[model samples]
Target: MSNDNDIRHGRHCVFLMHVHLVFVTKYRREVFTKEILDDLRPMLASVCRDFEAELVEFDGEDDHVHLLVNYPPKVSVSNLVNSLKGVSSRMIRKKNYPSIRKKLWGGALWSPSYFAGSCGGAPIAVIRQYIEQQQTPH
Candidate 1:
């Protein structure tokens, strides 16, 4: 394996873990402005750092955000998502309440549910082909 594919070493184990996360706004509201999305990236990075993870990529549409994250074996995905959503929601709302409140009238920024998927470093084309080839049992 090349250096790029080498596993990460923790105190007693070696592993590679990555996740793709999507967070949507409450009621699927289109509440995020360009400024809010820009501000959110750093906040997410900071949250990832707090969990000893790295935020690999961040982008989103007006109502949802997509994140690619690299995390260790010790971290729980659910817990990380909770923290990320909670902290970012609080901070963004605190700083941009006027804009946010207009769309998210309940004062909550994110919906309770979010989308998360594990990534195994496979090429997207390969994954798409594999999925497309799956068939139902007779």
Candidate 2:
């Protein structure tokens, strides 16, 4: 069971959904610097806000970024990913970091593919055991 505070109450439903998302740079280019990642954090948060979600955590390496987002059930992961990639890409490119632009010949910032995993809550084994112990109705 989740803590009561952790659960979110919507107008007609309750949910607590989190996704760990990983986005790699186009062609796996190493373009992000500390300054770039700093700038990116707020951009991602803003995008999440637009979707009525919260960006709980964010970090990145030169080649990729990881985001932990808490979202409502109404928001689809695909749509959120699209907005995150699109908005951040445009914003980053607009800054015109010569090193980044040079490395990425194409205008695209992220690869077409991404990794998203549902996170938080009990481990699968625990859930399985609990289900197995349940009493069946006659």
TM-score of 2: 0.93
Clash count of each predicted structure? 0, 0
Regions of model 2 farther than 4 Å from truth: 1-5
Give the TM-scores of the predictions, in the order they appear: 0.82, 0.93
For residue 137, model 2's alpha carbon misses the true position, in angstroms, by 1.6
lDDT of 1 at 122: 78
lDDT of 2 at 126: 98
Evaluate residue 70 in candidate 1 and report its C-alpha lDDT on the 0 to 100 scale: 85
Best-performing candidate as measured by TM-score: 2
Kindly list the per-residue Cα lDDT of model 2 for residues 67-131, writing each as its tens digit.
99999999999999999999999999999998688999777999999999999988899999999
lDDT of each: 0.88, 0.93
Worst 10 residues of 2 by lDDT: 1-10
